[model samples]
Target: MAVKTNCNINGIDYYRLRVTIGKDRKGKDVIKNFYGTSKTDAENQKDGWMKNKLLGINHISIRDSLSMAMFNWVWDVLKVSGIKVTSFERYEGIYRNYVEESSLGFMILEDIQRVNVQRCYNKLHEQGKSYSQIKNLHKVINMFFKYAVIEGYLLRNPCTGIKLDVYKKEEDVGEIDLFIEDEGTVETFTDEEIPVLLEGIKNKKLKIMVKFALGTGLRQGEILALKKTDIKNMVVQVTKTLSFAKLYDDADNYSYETIVTRPKTKKSIRKVPIPTELKKDLAELNKIRIEEKLKLGELYQDNDLLFPSETGTYIDSRNLLRSWKRAFEGIDVPYKKFHALRHTFATQLIKNGAQLITVSRLLGHASIKTTEIYAHVTESTKADDVQSLNSLFK
Candidate 1:
């Protein structure tokens, strides 16, 4: 016989399963026990004893407990906290791959010691993960142990003093200044290659979008958000952005959808000058829209998107990504992405000696510090400084 009960003991929650024998109305003895929660451990222990009588487990021994149940409870807590769906999914994967394989997964909560955590870190480090990755793993383990403490399964978290300082030094903290790709990093196109790329782009829209990204450093979303109304006389008001992401469940083999959202940050909301050269392209784009509207016997609405698909619908950014891949690959540039154009814009601005603050605003960076990464990526901006250093030798 077994029964279940829940109780809070000294500010910690616990479940008690117990068994006991009692006399029936017929004067026959029966046994039952259960697990339950109450205000105190004694009350919970009593409830568990009652539960044992009901379940008929006469020799029930609550010798050793499992920590797996407690770890699962912590997972539920994290899910309810609104962690990003993708991030939560990855966390679940980590639990299955790493935590479940570790011996600590089955240990009694009180038995989890610093050595247990250190062993887990050592195993992960041997698996070729970076120190940062190991550090994140530590955080997950620490959180589980803390939950154990709160659940009254353990007096204290045994992972408090686990040290991995020696492993931290093995991480390559050096500044890596290469454009990463699926395969590996490659040498990016130089400024001299820009003329060749411009010549290679045959599609007018592709050419315009590329130039816009390179000149204005607008994200694909910000560019997609542009409306005919957004383009006032000389200013391009960047109040909104168009983001393309895949929906969770779309059955029609559809892989992407466009959601009109605000820019990535409030600072990203600012006006940027429309380059004079872009005026001609904008005028042509507008003319095409007007002609399409006349063909359909409807006036072009004020809500007309600045960059629309061939059918006069809003363009899907996934299509734009595919187009970018095709366009850059066609030009024999080896590797160039939509973001690289933004990078090019920033690097070129810096090379031209634009102040960091001005460039930061142009790119809508939340902080000038983020814009500084571009300064590190491009060394051409320091050419003059190199010459200055060499001048002392002369």
Candidate 2:
């Protein structure tokens, strides 16, 4: 009979079972330990082991080491967890890039400590990975350990106490000026730059896309996923987003496919009101689309997309971005990423005295904190108001 005993390690309570196998060559008993979160769990583990031994089957626990556990967890568990395809790819990428080849990954599950996880993050930071990247990596690793702990594979999550902030480095102000800025600093076209941008774009389709993005504050993916039926009564319903993901076949061959998935979050499914001016523009665009369909006469592949490729399939995001850059040719205004159009929409709203909460709902942000990035625009507006007061005093 296997002996089961209550045990505590690192403040975690569990049960340990000691089993005696056949004696060694020297007539000494061979002992093995199986651990679990409770006595019944330990007994079940021991029973399974005994059954495997009786059948002459070699059974290795996934919790034996970090790499083995992570591989199984990612492929066997997380892959089928109903997450978006892009999200699965991101987690797999982080494991391949940061964890699988690292020293901590090779460590035994029991030997992994908080310091080991912290060291991994420190190394990533030292390698010039951005704070956001490290933070995302931490999220994946933490979830991995948390799952282990819940399954009794680990006594506690080694990632629980790790501090990511300590690994963050202060940005150099000079470097910021030289390089393109991050989302922390929202960039948008000025009122003067808008007309210049519109007139400069050579492709009529790309021009309409830009105008729609500016007016509605929809993400590039959301705009690309739009169907003609998604708009009704001068409102656009943002229910889905288009994504391009690299996927692997059973034979390990990789290919890219365009997928239409639900909006990023529940809030992203809300409707956005279309401006009166953009409504007229869309009606005109619809007429042009009808003309193109008739001209193509069975050659066109109609997907009913509001904005589709020349043949009516999904537009490749890369091609759109490339065309966008070329659209700025010989133009006076500096080029910004397509996302800047959405940023500009939010900023313009804030400047026009729209309430922050209202703006947050309009933009479909999951949290108000995300919308608060544009609060600085309000501060700048306040400074202008102060200047007007100074003029009045004069």
Candidate 3:
């Protein structure tokens, strides 16, 4: 049972509930304090503490553990803070991927020292986790403890002044002819592959999507969420991105629910210039869409998406991937991510003597550093540069 002490501090009312957490080495009653503005709030807090103790909750003996603290803070605070839906989902994903499955979740908040958290990170590294993966886990855990400390759930955060390092394993030296360096180069499709990809895509609408991806570096969700109004006066405005709640693909049916939200970052809301050739193609696409809408008559469902299904509703992202796979069926080029098209767009501009800042702006990159990742030096381009050395040798 917790004892409530009512006090008046300089005309302000305050209530404190002190609960017996455990016995110390000296046989003293180890206590935990929860303060509130009202007596009922103090009692409620005490009652909740008692309930946790009775229910054998591991994380709530005195203070919340990593699991409870993270979840409670997220659901109680982050959800109500009006964060973007996509960012909130990503934050939740970190908790699910890192804390939910780890041993650190059940440990007492005070008992978890810096070394204990470090070992957890080391275990993740040994389990072949990437640096980015471990970093995300660290981020969530770090923020969780910070929240706990701020809310008086814990005295100090264990994650304070800590660093994570993931050790990468060496692959077999003779297994492959050439090793792919992680950050040494950016991967993009060759000029020849573009034609094959376009030709392989039978659907005219899907073909237009691939062309747009190559022409502009819009993200998958951004492109899927585009509307007829988004394109105007030889320019495409990227304003919002589509958020998918869940996706289910069955043998007979496929479906998804989407929530349209603002673009991921501030830079993602910029406008991209549509080339002259692409403008003409888009004009023709509009004509085709007008003809289709007339044929469907009252049965057509118009969501105003630039690229919609025959029924005029937003296209399912998964179904769009099926179409993407069909487009690459006969292509001889190696498999690359769909995002590689964005890289291709940037690389073509750089190869044709376009400025770095120009490409950065066109891609809606927040910083020029991000755009640099898409800029790669090809072997052929290097060879051309090496030829310039011939004059110096003479």
The order by descending lDDT is: 2, 3, 1
Q: Which digits, one per residue and each the tens of the lDDT, describe model 1 over residues 225-327?
A: 7887887885788998775553332111224456776665678899888778888877877777777667765544435788776666777777887877666
Q: If scored against the real structure, what TM-score would every candidate get?
A: 0.58, 0.76, 0.73
- Tell me how many residue pairs clash in candidate 2: 0
lDDT string for model 3 (110-197, tens) is 6678877887888888887766567667776787777777777778888876775334333211111011111223568888888877
TM-score (C-alpha) between model 3 and the true structure: 0.73
* Candidate scoring better on lDDT of 2 and 3: 2
Which runs in model 1 stand beyond 4 Å of their true positions? Answer: 1-188, 246-256, 294-303, 329-332, 380-394
Off by over 4 Å in 2: 1-65, 167-185, 377-394
Q: Per-residue lDDT tens digits of candidate 2, residues 273-301?
A: 98988877897778768877888889999
Residue 136 CA error for candidate 2 (Å)? 1.2
Return the top candidate by TM-score.
2
Q: Which number leads on lDDT? A: 2
